[model samples]
Target: MYGLMINELKNVLVAFICTWGLQLLTGITVRNPLTLLYFALFWILGRCKKNEKYDDKKGKMADILWGAASIILSGSVTFFIGRKAVLGFDSGLFRLVGILIIFAGMFLVFVRLKDLPSLIKNIFSKDYSFLAVKGMMQEEKSRKELPFSDLKVLGISAVICFLCYLPYFLYEYPGIMTADSLVQYEQIIGVTPWSNHHPVAHTLVISFFYKLGLAVTGDINKAISFYTVAQMIFMSLCCGAVVLRVKRIVGGIVAPVLSLIFFALVPFNAVFAVTLWKDVPFAGIVMLTGCLLVDMAQKDRGVWSDLIMLFVLLVLLSLFRSNGWYAFLLCIPFMLYFYRDNLIKIAVMVAASVLAVIIIKGPVMTSAGVIQPDFTESLSLPLQQVARVLVNDRALSDEDMELITDVIDTTYIHELYAPDFADNIKELVRAGHPEVIENNKGTYLGLWLTLFAKYPADYIKAWFDLVGGYVYTDFPYDVGNVDGIMANDHGLVPTPLIGGKAVIKGKEILIKLGSFVPIYGMLWCAGAYTWLVIFALIAVLKNGRNKKLAVIMILQAAMIATLLVAAPVIDFRYEYAVVMLMPLTVSICVIIKSEKTAKEY
Candidate 1:
């Protein structure tokens, strides 16, 4: 392992040398150094373990050359296949195919095509044995099943979870809220137009509870309070369900007890439970789904009931967030492979989920008069390009200026152009510009390309500035106290909530501790999540059952990649799903590893 680590560092050093060598030759400074570091880190984490196994067999030079070749091949393939999508895909078909190709190529290289036959044979074997698949199966079978279900563990854990958030619930009574709630609530109250932008599925949930509250008590505020309580109940139950499942697998009261504290008492998570946001409910459901996935990963054979529940959760997951569908897209392929024993069942579920999304988001949403979101949301890179060009004060002819103005109004670019954010520019164009961006995409593409060719460094700088938060640790603290605060200017009734100063101070202190703490800070930053994903990948490559749970890391990687191209800002809420899953994930991995070690003894 030490030798393998040394080789990986040597590969990175070679890449670093070649990087500066190119800069010297071309006199063009690298645009996104973090991006390079990110890719190298990803490569190291994923491939280093495999290198360790092969180190004694392969010569040092062979190891170095192989690593370098792997890096070049992966990068070149991605650049060539994804270039069109980078400019912009005219059809969803192109983007979907491009992503599929990328993942396929990635799997082929990462798994080594030379071993394909053995891998497939192992997967299809009566008891899949590759990466200790059969060992995990044996462990599952050897475990004694309890004669009766223990509802007490569930009850106790749920109560603990509820109590953890009680302080926030009491302090911020009804909820720690935000402006987005009011925007979403307007549609539920029938005072504003309905739209899929806020996701009608979640809006309908709020509306049902609101009307239910009114029918019972005739007080709207009571409904808000009920809604907040309902969120807490749901989250608590989900956390409890996951803990119970873990307890069943590991056969310990202590680990389960500690798991409860981690889930219920973690500062950010505890505060997050009472905050009324669409993400809260979405995250709660995601946790429930994760439990189901974890159960499925441990068992040797198929369970029809669990499959049905997983299908339901995946559908709900895709519905609650706009980006949820993308995450699902990245997961389904792996699900097929991981559950290869139940190919037909997995296929049916995936197909049904996809069809449901198409029908609901297309015809159902359209019938309800849900206007499509702005085009600029999808054009983050292009918008950043325009902003960068404007910031440079580049000299342009009248025709060039006119061409740019035809796509985006250049007047607001000066004030709205924040290198680290795309929302300001996106909002400017959505407010004033015409919706001919798709129609005149060629012209827009030409302008973007011309600017890129002219000021590559500036474009690179903008990309890094916007995306560095996810890949680098020092990219400014942007996700501060977004929860536990209400929008004051939106004319919503003033919250009766008081003494929030104390709560705010508490949150600020937690954030600072997370940011500055030496070893513990990995739980806090965007870059830390990147490392978590990397660690999960290493765990997956080392074991196949681990792969079942760790495959979600692919979704994490894809989500982060999407953010690099499309996110408006670096918000912690964006990666909250990862935060919620990390503890449970580590616990499961540790338990399984301990079991394996005991068996070895």
Candidate 2:
């Protein structure tokens, strides 16, 4: 027990040092560099002692003493550098006390090093192999010859999906209206000019349903009410599609039922459905594409229906989100590799998708009078760096400042630039200097590259602040607020179609509960994304029979890569597709094991 405690203590110290050391590198915080350096030395010496052939109590004691001395040295260095007493003690006296604490720590380690090697061996030994092997054996014994049909699961889940969604739809009767939805509705009703700033395809779809509602009932409110109900049904069908795919992978009813409960009761999915965002249907389509991809892989000869679904899904996915098209382009090579045997079909699909993009984005959009998205949206990171450098008053040569001025009004960037987000800076840049950007792409690119070379640290810090939410859990930016996007705004007057103040308050409570509840909160956090990546990697590596699931990872990775470059800010909605798809990815890895995997079990 004594040796085990020491080993655990060492592990904790290593983790602490690594965590803070990384923060220091990311510019999240500042730390005494010497402290990190000494901890690294301590870890090294401890590992060396562990590998020694014979007991060396004296050497272990000496090593602990060295670590203690290094800590005291670091404290003295901190005092000299800052010329401030640590915790009210003089620098000299602080080092003296710190040295004493280190010595006490050393003595504890000296006492425990006798059995340290054996304790560590016991901790990391291969004894757990039997557990894995035994579990596999039991699974093999219990394995069914044929899996149950997924039809019942799908039917039950769809009913649950609708029933679970009813309360939210009722509470926010017409809809959980958002600013984006309002803008889209206004465009449809001729209150504002139609533009393709949001996807033209989604807007056209909304216009069709909304107009149908208006024609049938003659009341715009009733139209909205009908539209909301229609959205709920569409989203419920999406939930059913996901359940069907999951059922196939897991080969059981329990997992699908649990998934149904997760979707049925989880406030986020309900809120997502009720709130109309381009990302909502985009997420649905992405999942459908994944299901089709899996289905194609399961077949020896690819089905024509499956090929048609992929082609249509790729087109819809591209139109819904601007980056969707790019993500599809990135995934194509992998898709072809996965379907190497069906090259002709895959080739035709790609050629057709390319042609569709040209026609839809060019002539079709031109006829519809939808303006193309601004080019600056694709340049979020560079703009962030420029604004941050201007804010920090970082060293910029006179010529460099001139080049930047040609691209943006540098004077107002300091006032408008948000330190941890890129949206405000983006607006400032695009609005302030439209003419220069419209004409001078090469010059701006050159200036950006030169400034990056000059203030590399500021550049890195700026980017980390923007996109660090994906990798760092404690990233200070709050990008997951669905309230603004889902606020119950239904014109100036209150009506039955409008969600009243009480319903809005209830929605707020649900959001908080979804964020703080034990398992539920995981769905809302950036930390969950880190685990999703880890699990996806495990699935890709472990499930040899179904390596096609790695396509999901490929698509997810493409999205993340796009986020690094194009995300206006680290908003959770931007990565929602990845988060919502995790269950299926993990199920494919763990439950859909190959016959060889079953033998090992």
Candidate 3:
């Protein structure tokens, strides 16, 4: 017992040291104490003897060495692939290297056969037996006979979600509460008008109704009405799909009910469902994709259909917002790591999708704009800047950080940053505005260099801070009102009372009570923390060892991390999909646990 305790302590120490090292190396700042607490738990459990049997010193040594090597190799391969692609080389070499490293790592981790009694004992120990039993029971219950009428329950849930958002679609009272939504709407108009910046799937969907409404009344307002109604209908459909998917995965009436409550109660969902914002569509698409991917990964069926659907969804997500591309990139590592068996097919699908995107949205389709250059010419520089900020020992002022972020966002020197370059090249091809395009590119390049030369540390600090902020803040914080006491032009309501009063009137109302409520405002945070605990426990206990589910959990967690690092700026609207997923995943875990427990008895 003393030895076991000592080992556990060592594990905890390792986890803490590793986590701190990662924070320093990556320049990530985890603001939430809960996140850190979870990490600590993860480290201790991950190193527990029952979870991992490293009986032989030689084997343990090998495990450590190989694990480190595999990680390094994977990183190196990814870097080479990115570099080769950026440098206009045939990226196939790096792709091959990446594939080889991935396979090698998998073999090192899971392929070696071990048949020791201790290993078997470790796999089915009493410590984990309860969890296993719970998982089994849940699986069995989910598989049990179900009444046909339950399908109707899903429909009802969908209706409820739809009706909840009907008011926004039906009426338009301009106020401060709706300001963000209006800004998004205006942004859409600026980009794609009528068709808007919504995911192509959503915009196409709205366009269909708008055209129909046009034929009936030929009025923009009526067309907008049709668009709004379609959004509500589609959102309802998304909710229904979520309910059905959760029901199938978890089983029981409780699962669906809980899922409904969780999604329904979120203020973001309620408010944004009616407003014409891209978040609803983005959430719907991501949720649908997540459900499909989970089903495909877990069930081992519908591979082809799921892949096709995923492709379509990816295109829609990408077109919805630039950030959608991150979702697509995320899938690559997941497939490589967890679905290695389906690599060839997944690769084909991914390649085809990429080709389609390039062909459709490539320079050929849109008129190229003039190129601009800035001081942050190399990608490495921005990354270095990020590293500096993350590792900064001193405290930073809000203004200093904000200035750094603005610079980083504009001149990261990536292809995506060259917004005007394509336009310029197109004009040059047409012999129109050639000088303007060249000059624009020079101007951008010069500005980027100036920033790099003048404020390198500040630039780096901003990059890290931005990434850190995203990783840490599960909820939106008022940037203009840091310390939760100041007010600025960013237009966040000055106080809960004022913001609520502007939206809802009545002196007796508790306008921002949800912010303080345990189950309301903090639900997402709680759910996230709970998921980490449950997932780590399950992985340790060897309960419900479904690789697909594990992969999904890992991917979701990683995506959240990536989003934090890459695009930390989140509104309630932006995080709605993630918010909804938390409760759903937790409910599934609970069902699995309960069922497994019941079986044990």
Candidate 4:
């Protein structure tokens, strides 16, 4: 009894320490006390339920109610707090308090109302039918004969991935034409070797190649070429890794071949792979992380090693883009569903990840002074001036206009200064213009609203428009247009026979068609319309099944749905990273089904 108490205390201490350490490093305050309080309450409730005099069936009912309530309440609180924060309300403190109160009230109600568990059990008893289904699945797997030729499938996948990216080494593909790419290149080649706007991973990769190229050819262009080729090779290897993992799961050679074929044939994949953009790499890391997670779920041995790999992959993924932070959210469903039995371990892992991000982005860079911004005031002055103009119905003087432009240009340079608030403000002013400020404000608000509303269809349409606008105009041939052709306003170029139309029209048609067809397009969309049905069936049929797989599917669905709404006009380039996830998921699902079928036979 004493040992158990000590262990529980130790676990709680570890979670608290890790969370606080990360908060300190990141300089973010958890203003909501209720958040912590709720967690405490939940912990206590769980402990009490475990120690109750009730039988296993009764206690299980209590656990289920607790879980269901937690999910609903957490979602509600997150939604409200997120909205309040976005709208400029300082609700963090209140949110914390409210969560605590809610949790406390719920805990008291559960304690006082002993019949609550029975009520919940009556309401949710049907849900347990899924467990029986899952038991059958396990039995099926046990009865199946293990296949012998799986290794050959993995080998073939490797060969296919290698061949797909070979052209990138032999020929130059004009990289992703984004403002961000230019900034990344500058950071890599510049003497300072850092950019506040860009993440560290891609720049680091580029710098390594630059140095290597200088050693060999002594030409800057050659070095960039080498870097680009290397990035392509690495991306190709990621594709190969996904294919191999898929083969392992599916128990057939076809899965690997299909994954390779789908990946290679994707127009955006081909374009992004040949470029110096980080999207492909980011996608690779995410896929790799997913593969590792699946492995950890299946095999209980060496879990620590698998977890370490996940941590490293997450760090790398985070460094790929500012939005890369969202990738961490993937773990949420996994914890809530699959890792429920290991709550303490999950909490520790989350805390560790938060700390890693803070250390990488904060103190490490702070010591180097690479994040300071000057001209921040100048940047803000224009926004104020622009607001005055708009509100007062006055035109800006030519001098004011010029100052605003100068401020916008210089803001980027000023952001290089780290940790110094004054310098940071100055740089912000220099890099900002009235129009830029307005656009940013609008973009953020739009994104926030879209996510809160969760309108998946509207989100998908907007994303398509954004992609069409960016890629077709920037890189014509990737969408099946001829090279050297200039795309017009709608990302279409005039052709001798076709006159002028969007370059992506053809690609878009195929994407739409493939999305409906089985084993093609992105599996998420292919399965989107039927998602609720599929999920319902899985929940009922697969008991104690690999819960991680189901959680991943849920996360992916949520991510894609969020992307559909919140993503500022999408470019095919941005979509490139997420596209890899779909094929890999499909491969896993197929593998699971095949294994089940074999077992039944």
Candidate 5:
């Protein structure tokens, strides 16, 4: 009895520490009342029936991994966030204490998990294809017939998305043209040099519409507005297609209705739909590609057109952004594995896509003289790490100083060393003898590796400062407020068509509410979406036989992985693809897994 009481007390204390750590790690106010709720929840979980009789060594690995992830992740965020703090305790020491508490919290979580993993074994083990994705290939009849036809499903969903997006379009007329959009516009007008830095394919797409709009309207702003409206329609159709795909897979009006609500009402979708970013179209194709993968995997053989569509989309996917190509490449193995039943056709399509991408990106771009992005673009992590070492006055060998100064002027570093952003330092490299490191690849690699070994703690903090937002839920990214075009030198700016006090304030209220609203804002949260995807994947792994549903998720996961390694900015738009497909991901995982699947797994 005494032991149990002591254990409970320890659990409560651990819960408080982790709860506070999480609030701080996520940039939440330390004084929020929500900590008490989390503390109570953890205590209740700890007090639940505790037994480990059923779990095996294999399941223990899962617990350990989760615990280790919690410790490391929390520790990382804690260290990075506190780096600039003036607190008396050393930032490193504070991080160590935070990690210790987070570890204890993970212990409580393991206690809550109990022996469920071992119980998962019979726990209803069966043909997983039947159990996991039973709803995928066929449609179950509704208790009452759904009135909507297939075309109606597509049209209805599309119209709803467009209409929902209309307000954003009207609010920020001519579209939200930021720095990248302005650059694209300059390239379109022949004022700036052509470059694949902003994908030629995407630039061409914009060029087509803007030129057409000019011919029709003879007004640059109108042309831009025309492009925005057209983009909204195109993206709406894409989202509608996503909704239709999800509805068919889940079967019924309820799923479609809910999906419509998510696609239409979510501010991220609306804002992104009208935004003049290449990623908007890229995300659309990504979602469609995911849907197609789902369709092909759910059947023995897909329609004949699936191959052609796959080829075309893959080419465009590879062309839309550099990262898109890499992400697709990363998923090829997984795609082959999950959709192996249709191996020959899938392989042919993928090979063709790869060839097409190579041809376009290589000979085609070279012939067109589109300048590729500087090589320094790929060295975001290493650049930030080196800069951190310089900024913090860490001891460095003369050779290290020479190597860094060869690429970056240390004098400018004080002004350039932003903890989270790498662009300034990257520019510094470009400003210096940029090709020095590029030409000496082996030398640079050795320098990066050696520096990492020397400044392991600084390296970790530098990386976490940039990437922790994606892993920490409620990381305070403002998606809804990025409504209007930024000030641009090009003849591009916001020409808002709708603005009375009510309309403007209503939009303000929406954006402001998202900042403080608890669950609602998660629609725009990278970490929330990431965690949700992970949970769905776990569901698939524990219960599902074939991995089609899980395979489709690789689309988002691959893109996100690319971002983690090389993301320049922790912008909401970068992670929007995950948010776009999350509803479908959750729906499929939920439908496939049974009541017993949850109980056992």
Candidate 6:
């Protein structure tokens, strides 16, 4: 009893000190709410291993690894917040000591994670009692399950989604178009040469609707409005599909109702639905593709119709964004691994999709005089790494200097250096001397490798800065605040149907809420969604009942990995597919399957 009491006292000290330490690491404040959260986590973790014992050698190694991981995550979040907040972090001994204490506390929490898989498996057991609701739902399929019919429920959800987005569309009327949108519009209207930098397929999608509206309405603004309305309808239907699918899988109204709220009422979703970005449609299609994959996987066999649909979707997915194609190709291996029987059909669809992309990108684009994105677009990481070495004044050999000079004028390096974005450096290359690097790839590649070998630390810092926002959970993003299209000469402008301070404040509050609110704010965070995907994958693996869902999870993860490696900005729209996949990922936990299906994995 005395020993237990002493142990309990020691744990209390650990938890308190850790909580205090985390507060110091982030920011020392009297009433920082995160302090309470940290303490509770530490205390609970301590309780988890109250009497646990392990081999001294293995236990020491495990503790070291987990401790290192915890510190990295915590340190990344701390450093990112510091840089973004622009408050110079105190490099004091107290903060250093605080980090040490934090590591110890966070180690306690992570060490307890060893039991998480078993805990998840037990909680979401193979029996899947939650899914028994499906059988009851099947019995009542003919009968009106709720007061309203299922079709009516679906319509209600979609309409609500449309109606919620109506205000944003009207307020930022026609649609919200960033620089990329305006550039695409220029390509569409012949204001400039057509460039496939902003995926020509998506540009054509806008042009189709815009031109149709122009013919009917004879006003450019109204024509753009036409595309916005169509996009809203499509996105709403996607939300409706989510609602119906969630209802079917969970076999309950509660989960579906909540899912509807998430899809329809979230401010970011509404803003994105009306935003003229390729990512918007790409995200919408990713969800649909994921849903289709889930449906096909369950059948354990494929038909010709399924192959055709998958082929079309894969082609559309690829054409929507260049990265989307890479992600699709990445997913093919996982698909083949799990769904081996359907491998031949999957391969054929993928092959055909690749051929279509090639034809469109090569012959069709070339024939139409559409310019493709420059090779510099794919060199973001290497360029950034090289730029980092220059900006930091890292030691460079004469050969390294010559290689960089060949790519871009060395005099412009300081002026073009942007630690978090590669565009400026890329632009320098484009403006200075792209031809030299383009013509002498081998020399530059050697330079990049040599610099990497010498200044690996700088390369790591450059990567972290570029992608830190996507790695830190609470990183702030101002979504909906950037109202309206960029000032354009083509008569493209915001024609807000409503105007007032109240509307302005309402939008501001909604956008700011992401920073002020806790769980609700997490919805807008790409990093939070990234962790959600990781957690969902863990749950699926532990329960071992949703390998098909796991396939989709891996696909989402692959897409995120692509973003990490080559993404220019840590934009919410870029990671929006995983953000929108939240409800679907949750459904993976409760997907109904027979004993045979579960065992097949």
Best by lDDT: 6
lDDT of 1 by residue, 439-546 (tens): 788877887888788888888888888877777765556443555446544343425454557776776666555543223344556767766677766776575355
Please write out the lDDT profile of model 6 over residues 204-232, one tens digit for every residue.
Answer: 99999999999999999999998999999
Off by over 4 Å in 2: 1-121, 129-133, 136-149, 476-507, 541-543, 592-597
Q: Relative to the unseen true structure, what is the C-alpha lDDT of residue 93 in candidate 4, on a scale of 0 to 100? A: 59
Misplaced by over 4 Å in model 6 are: 1-150, 590-601
Q: How would you encode candidate 2's per-residue C-alpha lDDT over 1-601 as one tens digit per residue?
A: 1344456467546534433323222333222233334344444445544445535888768667766765565445444432332233335764455344333434333433443554456458843231233443354345442244567666667778888878676665566556778788878878777777788788888788888988999887667767667777877777777788877777545556666776777777787776668887888788778778778878887778888878899999889888888998898898888777888888898779878987999898889777887877777888888777889988878888777777676666777887667778778777677668668888888988888898899998988888877665544333334543243344512144437688777767677654322234456665456557666766675755666667887887777778877777767777777766766776676554544556665
Rank order by TM-score, top first?
5, 6, 2, 1, 3, 4
State how far residue 112 of model 6 sits from its true place (Å).
Answer: 21
Q: State which candidate, 1 or 5, has the greater lDDT.
A: 5
Query: Across residues 1-601, which tens digit of lDDT does each residue of candidate 4 receive?
Result: 1344454565354334333322222223342233244335334333433334656887778767866775565456435543343333245754464344334333333442343354356447653221123443444344432243546544555556656655433333323334455566666656355755556667678778868977898765565556766766676667767776776665444456677887666554555565566666777777777677667767754366666776677677666764566646654655545766655666666667778877877888777655522223223222322322323333444554454464355333323332211233344444455345444655534433434254444433333443332222221112311232233222212222221345345445443433222222223222232343244336523742566666545544544444443343333445445557666666556556645655654
Per-candidate clash tally: 0, 2, 32, 32, 1, 0
Sorted by lDDT (best first), the order is 6, 5, 2, 1, 3, 4
Residue 86, model 5, lDDT:
20
Clashing residue pairs for model 1: none
lDDT, residue 381, model 6? 79
Cα lDDT, model 6, residue 377: 87
Report the alpha-carbon TM-score of model 3 versus the true structure. Answer: 0.55
Residue 413, model 5: lDDT of 87
| TM-scores for every candidate against the unseen true structure | 0.70, 0.75, 0.55, 0.52, 0.78, 0.77
lDDT of each: 0.66, 0.67, 0.50, 0.49, 0.74, 0.75
Q: lDDT of candidate 1? A: 0.66
lDDT of 3 by residue, 320-405 (tens): 65456665666667666566677777778788877776665555334433122222221323433433433443354555445434
